[model samples]
Target: MIVLLLGILVLAIGGCVCVVWADRGGPRWVRAVAAVTLAAGELLRIARRNRRRSIKRSSGGDE
Candidate 1:
């Protein structure tokens, strides 16, 4: 669980760095890769968070 969260965070920070680097006139390929990585990382994080939320909501009603 913690590992996943850390991986996601690391990817996210790396993604942002790529974007900044690309915006400053880095190679086209760099920019493309950064965008792709950023999107993938965000999607994974969102999915994980959403799954946790659903679990919490479902389990709490019994309390």
Candidate 2:
């Protein structure tokens, strides 16, 4: 389990590096990886926001 978490952390860091490198005119593969990482991050952000909204509604927080 620990190994899996460490692997994920490494991948996340690598993806971030790719994003920065792409911004600085890196190779095609780096740009592609950065794009994917950015899109995935956006999707996750949206999903989390929607989940929070749903939870708030269920708890009657609109009052």
Candidate 3:
């Protein structure tokens, strides 16, 4: 389990690096990895936002 978590952490760091490099005109593969990373980040952000909205509605918070 620890190894898996470490691997994920490393990958996330690498993805972030690729994103920066791609922005500065890195190779095609780097750009591809950056695109995937950005998409995944956006999806996760949207999912978390939706989850928060649902939780608020359930608890009777103002819409």
Candidate 4:
């Protein structure tokens, strides 16, 4: 959840940069979508990893 939110916020900042330097509003969409997808994937991965770690710890597997 936190990771997803952070990723979205980061992607939004990157999108702002893309638009600001879009040259003529041409390459704004593809890059933005690509960036958003990447961030979303990363966010999911991070959340999954954290969930696994917590599960392991709670199960006394941390030893």
Candidate 5:
């Protein structure tokens, strides 16, 4: 689990780097990686938010 988390963190960082690189006209590949990374991050964020919402709902909607 720890390894998996670390891998995700690495990917997130790589994605951020790619975004910056692409913005500075790095290359087509960098832009592609940036797109994928940003999309994955967005998906993960949505999933996490939904999970938290479900947990809150299950626990009588308490804060």
Candidate 6:
């Protein structure tokens, strides 16, 4: 489990580096990785918002 988490952390860090490099005109693959990373981040953000809303609703909280 720890190994899996470490792997994920490394991938996330690599993706962030790719994003910065792509902004400065890195290679095609780096740009591609950056795009995927951005999309994944967006999806996670949306999912988190939805989960929060659902939890709030379940607890009878008004948003």
TM-score of each: 0.57, 0.94, 0.93, 0.54, 0.77, 0.95
The local lDDT score (0 to 100) that residue 16 gets in candidate 2 is 100
lDDT of 5 by residue, 1-63 (tens): 999999989987888999999889988999999888888889999999999999999999968
Instruction: Tell me how candidate 6 scores on lDDT.
Output: 0.99
Q: Report the lDDT tens digits of candidate 6 across residue range 1-63.
A: 999999999999999999999999999999999999999999999999999999999999876
- Candidate 3 lDDT, tens digit per residue, 1-63? 999999999999999999999999999999999999999999999999999999999999886
Q: Give me the overall lDDT of model 1.
A: 0.86
Identify the runs in model 4 with alpha carbons over 4 angstroms from their true place.
1-26
TM-score rank order: 6, 2, 3, 5, 1, 4
lDDT of 4 by residue, 1-63 (tens): 999999979977776666555545547585666566667768989999999999999999856
Top of the candidates by lDDT: 6
TM-score of 6: 0.95
**How do all the candidates rank in terms of lDDT, highest first?**
6, 3, 2, 5, 1, 4
The 10 consecutive residues of candidate 2 with the worst lDDT sum are 54-63
Worst 10 residues of 1 by lDDT: 54-63
Candidate 4: 10-residue stretch with minimal lDDT = 17-26
Model 2 agreement with the true structure over 1-63: per-residue lDDT tens digits = 999999999999999999999999999999999999999899999999999999999999785
Pull out the clashing pairs in model 6.
none
Compared with the true structure, all predictions reach lDDT values of 0.86, 0.97, 0.98, 0.74, 0.92, 0.99
